[model samples]
Target: MTRHHPRPRPLAALLALGLVVAATALVWARAGAGPDRCVERAERAEQRSELVTGTGPEVLVIGDSYSVGAGVQPDQSWPVRLPGRVRVDGFSGSGFSAGASGCGDLSYATRAPRSLRTTTRLVVVEGGLNDTDQPVADLEGGARRLLRLLDGRRVLVVGPPATPDRTWGEVARVDATLQRLAGEYGASYLSMLDADLTYQDDDLHPDPAGHREFGDIVAAQVEAMLTSS
Candidate 1:
């Protein structure tokens, strides 16, 4: 008896080929889109953050996701709700040299040059959690670059809030270094570590109510800074 080999199953072959092609296309799409999307989103966030569209002139606040209000509405973001016309230059996933994404080299040093004008009033910078792993030298350098850019403008440097992702020890180091930099530059330093606040599910950012409280504290700090200056 001659047994003929079963003919190649056209349906099975087609389904296998289809799956392979689909998977390949998906990988290609992700590979092409990932970095470009990162940069594009970052740029758009920056553009949105810089509008001088408030009541009058503006106070500037610059930082990462927190400053941009990641988990909340643009209007509800603390910077917009802040007591004055506020110009902001915050972007998510940004830091001096470290962050949760894109490895974060988007430091204030890089931003303030392009974002700040000589006429800007006071600037508040809220970052540190993103700089948790940064070298003291790098952190200081970033802060100094920003302070120099501000020159005669009043500035405040805000420390990050508590996050379970980092040990308090790691967070403290960054805060201490920033505190030193603030003193050196005469920019005020406000530690959220000292605030009575609540956080969102992510624990990395604050909720709407938290932002309101945060805006109040920042307003108070700015008022004091303005009065003292």
Candidate 2:
């Protein structure tokens, strides 16, 4: 007499398979699945209007983790904290030339078109820190490409802040490049090279207090630029 064990049940196998798939999906999502998953769209609608249209005042802001408020809430981001309605589109680990290592090709230039709107009077592009390791030419070219797409529109290029972990020289180079491009494109440039900003545990992103301080500084700068223009 032969003793044979019952084959594994199809239903049990299917359940186990489903769990595995679900776990994998969760991991993938956390690992920068796509722009929708990584790029945060935040808006502060109740503030005073700056750039107005039929739909009301709106400003488009695009950048990386710093712009996305990496360590804080959506409302805490500098863009959102700025006066008026701000449509902030931020992808972590991205920049003008640098693509997010985990989030596919989500550079400032690549995401610019999607966020640009006719009604918006101002387009604020805040980034460059991620491109610190990239070549100077690459950074310039990337910024130029994005500025070209924003031709004829109001643009404010806010260079990345100096982080404790990053080399100050590289950060300054990126800032200088962005400043030059902003001048060429007739856009306003806000250099953060001298900004004494605090960061989170990672030493890369700003903390809540840092975001607030950054927002205040940027808000003042933006207001002055708009008033002059």
Candidate 3:
């Protein structure tokens, strides 16, 4: 008597397995491709040290890469360009809920404690673009949490500008969310959604010229708020 051969696996089953493997591999690659968390944390810690040791800046600007000067020089960044002593606590690839590999969880709220200082006359919260993909509830929750932390302080919530990489709808939603939160928290809101801005090759971050323009716009807003107050 001959032994029965093992039954062949179905082609559809094999194809499904391959797709799953491919998708999993992609996720892993993306996860590993993010900036080193340790380095990011160290840099953030350095920023805190500077703020703590040196003369506290008049304006404390907290944001993502735009505040960090992603593709430009330190002085070229808009935060430094703002008309007064400004200290930036910008983390690239970070947002209210967008925490990269090594950055702290729920980035903005987690670091607000160390970033704000007694000398900071104005707290300019400048971001939301990174959280474009976040659910409205999550985005609102994150903004509320950060705003609560800044309660009783002078705050200017600067929402994200429109970018080529992001849909107008997506950017507008973020802008709207931040604006609502700012109003509820007694903070002034500045929306950059309509600004005609330029960006780097990536179409995400602003170029040198764009930084200058952004700085000018923010400076004007800051001045107006401070003057009125």
Candidate 4:
């Protein structure tokens, strides 16, 4: 009878298995370390938190078509449906750049109150969609100017909603610039593009259901911020 010996496991195979295990453990550790980064990323990616609130403290929503009703009813808009006592100053067609032609500017400059006086504590800005046609630097400068106009009021900077067009890369650039501005100014930066409200009848404006969903997102963020503040 010949002696038989069990074969040793292949070193390369063992190494590969080890690497996989190590990678999996590393991922698990990272995920367990803090607030679900994945969930946060998903939420931020959706860009649904454009409308900021200050219900208990006082709140204001100011922007263009995205802020306004667009295809949705005025009451269904985030600024309108947000919980608690809130005020809306949204204009349907405004842009950040001065004299920028569109519904945002006309509504913002002509209709919306220049200075909120009703014990206003928080302000949400939702413009810049129209500004995509302009240069990024111009858009940034316009945003800065808008922030300056707000004075001492606590503000939240909301970037424009995303469109289905692949060529409209300017939206990302504008959103990034606004987010940087928000950080510089110590304000909240919410991305309408990340909110996942991209599906619209015209591929530009959100429908009524979209508005309601967006409003809920904004309301949650506002409520949390106000409660903490």
Candidate 5:
């Protein structure tokens, strides 16, 4: 009888390859999944509030370095330009998923409620650029947590702007996730990628002029929403 022996090495190699492919597919799928659902209602409230308020509504801008106007001053940031009392609660070096243990205690979602007690009419949460470097699951969980915290509030989600170093595909994915999250949470989603281009500097953080231009675009969108409402 002929000895029948399977090639263990080839089989092992094929199995490893299959595992790698499957893992990659899973990561891709998770990354592509839409934003967290907890904040959908807040997103909607933002739109409705915009339509009803007419010109300008109270806004709370919360995030990391981006929202803090890293390279710019306080006055140039969008939070400084909104019609009503605009409170800026962004922290430098704080990632969207960052907690007290990671970097700082001021998370965009957590610090927001604590800082602004008087029923802020609108809230803008922007972060995730830092989280992109972490695991996709971590990003999703952090986003969901933030959404949950914003439940029953009005919110508008600003996503990560495009960078020359990052691929357009990555930007699109991030933006898509943001839009989906806004939709699910009932908030309005705005793209800052295009607005970023109008700025003169190529630094990850925009300059004062860049901040001013960004503020204008954001103000216009807020105005439009208020007018429609």
Candidate 6:
């Protein structure tokens, strides 16, 4: 008869079992094995920010502090990376208006006419952080109004970027709401709500690199709009 095999070591067996469990969990998570995994993966994608893609028209950019290069140098702003002739009329602490309270009743739409020169081929509505304090209804209405004013122009509504302090839900709401409004008004929407995007130490404004990233993203979108139109 063959000699009896040495009994498996209890500690070794437990350790092996633990490793198998951990490996299985990792694989399951990556494969989106269940509802929790699916949600987790979706969340990861939603929160990521990296390079973005196009060339196009003489574009006009209107936004808030993010538009104005809050913490970063002026050259790092998103508007600086546009294709063709660009006009940047970004307000540091202003947003669209649904009433007298929003941006002193002079919103991007109201201020846009004055900022235009030659022929504005595209209107990039950049930031809405100033509208965060405003009621949601007002924000939506203001966006609607501003988009309406850009009527025939190729308008790109770039949703407000997400900050570390703001929960995912808050940022998602702002982004989804604005995107919906953009769709309603026949404008294209580009979300800047990725959590992985760079930000300043304050965690509010984009760092120089972040702005550059945003610029690249908008440039790509601009190219698409121009080519398609």
Overall local distance difference test of candidate 2: 0.74
The sequence of per-residue lDDT tens digits that candidate 5 reaches over residues 110-150 is 66556555657777777656555655565566666778888
Clashing pairs in 6: 53-220, 54-220, 54-223, 55-223
| Candidate 5: count of backbone clashes, pairs at least 3 residues apart or interchain | 14
Q: What lDDT does candidate 1 reach at residue 183?
A: 91
By lDDT: ranked, best first: 3, 2, 1, 6, 4, 5
- TM-score for predicted model 5 compared with the true structure: 0.66
Q: Rate the local accuracy (lDDT) of all candidates.
A: 0.73, 0.74, 0.77, 0.64, 0.60, 0.69
Backbone steric clashes in candidate 3, count: 1
TM-scores for all candidates: the values are: 0.76, 0.74, 0.78, 0.67, 0.66, 0.69
Query: Cα miss at 6, model 2 (Å)?
Result: 30
- Residue ranges of candidate 1 with Cα displaced over 4 Å: 1-37, 50-57, 98-104
lDDT measured at residue 182 in model 1 versus the true structure, 0 to 100: 87
Model 4 quality (TM-score)? 0.67
Stretches > 4 Å off in candidate 5: 1-56, 99-106, 196-202
Q: Residue pairs in steric clash, candidate 1?
A: none
Q: Which residue runs does candidate 4 get wrong by more than 4 Å?
A: 1-55, 103-113, 165-168
The candidate maximizing lDDT is: 3
Candidate 3 lDDT score at position 102: 28
- How many pairs of residues collide in model 6? 4
Q: Across residues 22-99, which tens digit of lDDT does each residue of candidate 4 receive?
A: 876674453332135434322432332344444466676767666656655455566766655666655443567653
Give per-residue CA lDDT, model 6, range 105-214, as digits (tens).
44677777776656777778887665665678878887887877788778889987778846667677778889898998889999977635787887778888888888
Q: How far off is residue 64 in model 2, in Å?
A: 0.6
How well is each residue in 98-197 modelled by candidate 3, as lDDT tens digits? 4332234646887789878777788888888878876788778778889999998889989999999999999998898888889988999999987888
RMSD of each: 9.5, 7.9, 7.4, 20.0, 13.4, 19.5
